[model samples]
Target chain A: MLIRELERLENLLQPWREFEYINREVFRTLSPVQVEFPLVNLWKNEDKVVVTTEMPGVESEGVEINVTGKTITLRFERKPEELKDGEAYTRRERRYGEFKRTIELPFNVQSDKVEAKFSKGILYIELPRAEAEKPRKITVKSE
Target chain B: MAETVKDKNRENRKIYAPAVDIIETTNNILLFADMPGVNEKTVDVTVEKNLLTIHGMIEPTIDDKLTLVFSEYGSGDYQRVFSLTDEIDKNNIKATVRNGVLKLVLPKTEKIKTRKIEVSGEA
Candidate 1:
């Protein structure tokens, strides 16, 4: 009986160990990408799929959004001004240039009804499901 | 183990600029630089005599409407220079910046590829 409890405890800790191992591996793989940029989160609700991307220092007008089939593309470019030739720089660290990212949608999205909003350096995209793809309630009667 | 420890110590030594992480893959080399609050036009990347230099300037964030409650990230310009060896192809260095992340893709030159030749006795 005591051995059974120990086995149960080991089984509970196994998942935690696996989680730690996976987290460490991900960190090790991403260690070379030194820039700590904002993260993107995607979630699916009943009727719509939402995508939120954190893009600080980017203006709403600068971002270009395109949707084709089940894929969404985002493209933008940043251009900073030049400083005086005689001026000296102390510490400078900020990324500037064109960036493009494309994501595939899990389900078929209604291309015509897609909505995009940008606020506080965050871009939010809402993709509603087509009429045929949406879930419908069905009634069953016993024969 | 001792050599690895020494290498870690060497990497820890701070220079005047921020440390950059450069990752080399099969197709390109991704350059991740920590540059806070730097915009597009202020950033300059140039390669001269096999020396790659990344210069960035961060403008101060001063908004009258927004009230500052707490702040942790610092605001400063970033400058780092890397001496590139013959491993990187000089002609095909491409750079892109997005959301404060600078991605540089350095393509390898054809001359850098290894070639095996057959050895035969002279006829």
Candidate 2:
């Protein structure tokens, strides 16, 4: 009974025995396999809300952008390569799949007048604010 | 048994080479793998006997009728093998995938030396 308890204790304590070296090895082996993708950023301006995302290596037509009222959605698909028979891959790390991301805006936006542009793997979305939503300046009179 | 282990290790090492980035901080080590389109269902990450392996399959999404205008990222299967030494708390390793980025947090082992002390004596 005591031996079994000791074994269980050892098992529980195993992960804490060697963390530094494992971390170093994990970092050392990561450089060649690292993949970087685009991140989406949304900000509001005086007249519009700008959405920018890094999407390097994707075609403009392959991406679909849609907006409904206060919500915006994006969807895209990527294809994999064709391999010949009897040919084995040495190193394969790129990803090819479909993805979708949707974000909600603080205020209602005009979907019909929205503008989108893709250049150098970056997608820029400009959403014009409704006439009522734009900030208005009012003069204050001293009483 | 040792020879077989070595042979298997060599075979695994030769099969797929994945580029990896290991970011180390005070609390843990973050492993970021550029596995572009690998879904969570198909991806596998395992650690055994100090050896960590990440393997997954990436399928193409294009059709025959479509023509590609530009492509900077290639799509294919993903595989990476790593041999770890001491310094990892294997049991506490955590992994999460978001937006095609595989993030792994490897915490430092409690038994490993983490600090040094300086002793002073009166002359």
Candidate 3:
């Protein structure tokens, strides 16, 4: 009797699970709103501004970084994986395509001295502050 | 293993559900999960009794001296779980991490065959 009851409960719950999966799939595919791509974070101290962004599945060689004055631009391309002869994607939530992002800093940056590194699909950039933009410590002489 | 230790430390930390893409072939199912900032050392994949779980730990990349000026995305650990059917070969499942993406290949134990039956009319 216990085994029969358990089987009956399983049969009842199976459709609910399938319904939930289908609901999620429809909502994700039909939603028109989209979030901004390649989200970034910026940090600063005294000498330089550090920026980071996550780009999973992207290689280092495909990324391009440009710095002009206080502005930094990042460009990259994420290619979609090709399916084999009999393979088909049942669910696809990851985005893939060409992407470009531009960031402006509050202070001027040394464009030539800017450095960037890519590892494990994360982009790290350091933009040194321009010499003229550095905060100068004013000395108060005893009068 | 180290998995238990990390799970204990996850009390106050936020966990994010990483986006994934799942593909199905004739003999295998493939799953790709995006988990940036997690490398091989911090990722754990396990399967027990038809339950598959994926966990990836992330260490803060920003230095202590640096103050966040602007932000858009939050850094956190990634975790997801899925239920598997008995048709999958659980013992032979393979997982690999590359460029912050985790790929899991689950092979089916047997091919699902379709049989067509022929009907004969009695004379």
Candidate 4:
């Protein structure tokens, strides 16, 4: 459909392309997750804010997530694999090291009501709007 | 097997080129591919005529009930091909898929394997 084509065009211009998955990101002098944004998809409805992030190789044991009302922080580390005694490295593209990022949400959400799920290397987090923060319907007055 | 080849030939559908990491070890060459939504039951790794192909069948929707408000990845099948040479032992290659990471170990052929020379004691 035309919509799908448009979306793909948009994706091509996104910063994700800057990383290029391989080749370029590997050449960066910095180590893992430095100055990088995990592919994130965010949306909001009347009652909740939902965020999904793609993290292929990160494991639960090494990952840490924290929430503070309007912000979320993720931190993790992946150790580098050492080369074998006689083997030589032909290509070095994958990167490994410590990664940490804090993201600010558009609106304040209930910290206690945040629910997270990890499936298929994607992390989904849902935060419900606080009772006080929910918009109340105003009755229209007629003259 | 038939389904995989069909999928490979599937046209007009989105296909994602999976990100890859290649590492060489003393005894083997390892490849790591970031291919989420693919499991052992659905992954296909094949070698034919010196061409190595990796295909991962992915589900279209994770949960149909949950409305997709936005998306960064238009999630689709993962496909990539690599050229293999005599240095690799195609018959003995091993692969494992866990938590969306595909680990492939290609054992080096005997000819390229580095063997330590036996040192003789001084007579």
- On lDDT, the leading prediction is 3
Q: List the candidate 2 regions with Cα displacement exceeding 4 Å.
A: A1-143, B1-18, B69-71, B116-123
TM-score of each: 0.41, 0.40, 0.82, 0.75
Q: Report the lDDT tens digits of candidate 1 across residue range A121-141.
A: 456788887778889999998
lDDT of 1: 0.60
Q: How well docked is model 1, in DockQ terms? A: 0.03
> C-alpha displacement of B23 in model 3, angstroms?
0.8
Per-residue alpha-carbon lDDT of model 3 for B27-67, expressed as tens digits? 78888999999889999998878778888989988889989
lDDT of 2 by residue, B1-123 (tens): 998985565453312234455655544656666554555776799987777778765544433343333343344456656655578777888987654556677786766635557889979
Among all candidates shown, the one with the greatest TM-score: 3
Where in model 4 is the C-alpha error above 4 Å? Answer: A1-35, A137-143, B1-11, B60-74
Please list all clashing residue pairs in model 3, or write none if there are none: none
Candidate 1: segments with Cα more than 4 A from true spot: A1-38, B1-123
Query: Model 1 residue A111 lDDT?
Result: 89
Per-model DockQ against the true two-chain complex: 0.03, 0.03, 0.46, 0.29
How far does residue A16 in candidate 1 sit from its true spot (Å)?
17
lDDT of 3 by residue, A81-141 (tens): 8998877888788999999989988689998898898877789999999999899999999
| lDDT minimum window of 10 residues, candidate 1 chain A | A1-10
Per-residue lDDT for A38 in model 3? 94
